[model samples]
Target: MRPAFVAALALCLAALPAQAQQRFKSSAGDLVVETVAEGLQNPWGLAFLPDGRMLVTERAGRLRLVSSDGKLSAAIANTPNVTGRGQGGLLDVALDPDFAGNRLIYLSFAEPRAGGNGTSVARGKLNQADTALEQVAVIFRQMPTINSNMHFGSRLVFDRTGALFVTTGDRYGQRDEAQNPANHIGKVIRIRPDGSVPADNPNKPGWQPEIWSIGHRNVQGAALHPQSGQLWTAEHGARGGDEINTPKAGLNYGWPVITYGVDYSGLKIGEGTAKAGMEQPLFYWDPSIAPSGAAFYTGERWPGWKNSLFVGGLAGQMLVRLSTQGEAVTGEERLLDGLGERIRDVRQGPDGYLYLLSDDAKGRVLRVRPAP
Candidate 1:
């Protein structure tokens, strides 16, 4: 090697530690996963800060800031009171589209009410120094509280024009509301950054125009296609019908009318799999993986997984990677089963590697990278 070239290589090697390459790794054809960070508490959602820190939400109504060096900050103060029972509590976290310039973050939680509880979305500015939230405000609240504590599907995604999309659940056993136009439950809703209904939304006159799509049962994972910018969601159906649906404006997603799964009590669910006036799922799971926290792999680290969708599986306790061919969902790969934990959230980190949040009292934040 040339002297100058050798000198430059030495400088670069000295800058990065030897363990940096091992910080994340994938082995055994991406089937085996190693731990990155542990001791989390039922981690539900994670958002990346502009400075490369991670903002993680716990199911017990706590928000924690995790550093790149694996240090977790104290629980964030001033989180909204949540009804942490069954499948409810503090949920998804999303950064503002202008987060690089604004330092703003949003959180979704199950807000307790008199008769029942409702899903709520709030936005606040994050103070990295103190690891706290400031100027927090409740932006949107779901309509008509329900008695059940299950099925609060709260995920946030922003459109190209900066409009926010929020998903809600049917509140367990409320099959009829999932298809109801009057109720916001079991629907994908769109709103402005400040939580006002967009004027261009469908049914702007008498209807609750925030609703973008309806008839969804309990959608937990949603992501925008990196190429086409279209929205997609993975929802939990009954026994066998976990579905990945392409959401369309003003369309019903046939929760109670058509499903591949039966009821939890071994009863029939809806009419059948194909029904008129209802949209069909792009793909579905027979035994049900309970998908959550989806993302398109546009990162450079995963060259083979470019444009593919990665979903966390709670019921299957694995990471699912789906190959996409221009709106067609095909080819599934399950990873990290031997890790023995339910993956609740998956996102590609700003460093171009994948990050996963295990859902349990002894949860963990793990990183995945190409194996050495």
Candidate 2:
């Protein structure tokens, strides 16, 4: 074929969107990228309702439902108050395992408290009308809230046993706090749906009972492994060193003490890349991609991607697919860089489709389907 012909073909393929010309090529196979919804302001999180509609959170502190047909609902009434500062606002949302019966849902947000602001998790019931959250109460609060507006590392995940796992940041300015499990900053906390600590938790003397693991930086993305039932997280590093970690209870995942990246100022960070007792990451990315949301694909829509882990990127503005073999990341592939949007979250729909939320002033919810 002539070069001009090949160039024209590429341009035509690049025009794919929600309707005509929706097919795009990927290593796995051909994929049809469809715009399920658009015009969301910095959509930060997404959760599917039992009936098939989606609950989406805008970073500016509003919660809306996006119908499958592409209609976006008005902001749901009575969402908990949030602090919409730098990286702070309404964040991740998750439905209760028994949501069909209890109508309970969990939300993680940057909470404005007396000291300043910090990440907090709350639970509320979606009323029958679907217009409001009723019986809302904060289930967990980051202790001794700092004055900084950054690093409210948060993502809500529910394990197989009804336990709620909350991930937190080091509150930016206080990186040292990540090493100390006594405080909530930079920790993965495990708690009951009602905000009570589990009796079987690490509960180390002098340490907070809710802490499941420690020494994490700004871990914005997390998901439970479909087959292993283990919790995996994607975390942000300074200049480099984005990491994927499968957190185990009471383990310390060296942050400042043993980072693969350096400080933003080009200065060395931590003691080094290794330590005696700290846990090493399963994988790390140099020139950090600023990862945010994570999901494990167990669906059949993309057979080539089955059992793979998908993570969304903010700084890198793409979707990353990591081939996995039982908790091990074997290889990595970056997708959607041409979309030119910051992927804030990734999800797998019940019907075996992959969904994404693009973060921007005019964000979009996109669906990826098998193309003919």
Candidate 3:
């Protein structure tokens, strides 16, 4: 309240790093964004343990834990071998539904194979000492590996029925294969936790038994609707037409065949925008947000944001909030407007806060909470 005290406080605050000093406002309300930790190399995905610590993955094939006090642990050892080049690397991480008891975690990574590499999902039990993964096993692999380094659409989501859904990309050079369900180039794959094909999957003749849906370009974000229990996904578009789709059973999404986006060369793409057999998007962004990670906020810490979906904007370098009712997205707002950082993943922490991973050579773990 005094002038001298105010000057001293300003000097003290200015001495702190930007991570602790930055704040922003959103439609929900004003927010305080603080750095939980730093020194992450292109961090891609994050999952929280029940004990309030975090499991975060770096793109260079290491998994690390961030304590509640913002201390980052040494990289957990014994992770599977990843290609770790281009868009290929350790991507997304998720805990098993019963992780408290099973201690099992799943990882999606760019896997090296005979021909080249593809997205692969593996499950392993975390040791009690927090040092390494034990008994790791590959559960699913995108069919037909390719040499290209882009479009490894690798997000892991577990549905209400406990089936794990893995998103596979068109492998850059294979965009046309998205329409073909016989091989798993660009598709949402459904499999049991143990890698078995579900009997309920559409087992049509000539279709892969694990195929849940077909015709996707490069889906990097996927999450379950808190109320409807449906899987929602956000994918990258070439130049425009980034989409938010709720992929359904055995449906076609019409990626390369029909899209609102044009090719990188500014030429028309696909067979116009619609076709008879393909399903439409719930929402889409033109001029492209290049959405990467997604989550539906069900927390009470922030007003006007309950049940709203939060998506990370990679190319846009911000966060997008979508107001929702049940499964339909009704409105959209952009947050962290001038914060020039590539948001790679978004998650709702157990403490009713939102957490984000900034994708960079020197990435950071950022926590967003209500401002006082």
Q: Quote each prediction's TM-score.
A: 0.91, 0.94, 0.94
Per-residue lDDT, model 2, residue 344, is 94
**Every candidate's CA RMSD:** 4.7, 7.3, 6.3
Instruction: Give the C-alpha miss distance for residue 144 in model 3, angstroms.
Output: 0.4
Off by over 4 Å in 1: 1-32, 128-130, 204-206
Global lDDT for candidate 1?
0.82
What are the lDDT scores of the predictions, listed in order? 0.82, 0.88, 0.89
Candidate 2's C-alpha runs over 4 A off are: 1-23
| Residues 1-372, model 3: lDDT tens digits | 465754554353223243654678887678788888899999999998876678999999999998756778999999999999998899999999999899999999999988799999999999999999999999998989798789999899999888999999999889999999899988999999999998899877778999999999999999999989999999998899899999998899998999989999999998988999898888999999999999999877875788888999999999999998877889999999878889999999766778899999999988787787
Whichever of 1 and 3 has more TM-score, that candidate is: 3
List of clashing residue pairs for candidate 2: 153-169
What is candidate 1's lDDT per residue for 212-326, written digit by digit as tens?
9888999899999999999989899889899998897788898888999998889997788898889989899989999988999997766778988999999898888888989
Models ranked on lDDT: 3, 2, 1
Off by over 4 Å in 3: 1-18
Report the C-alpha displacement of residue 254, candidate 1, in angstroms.
0.6
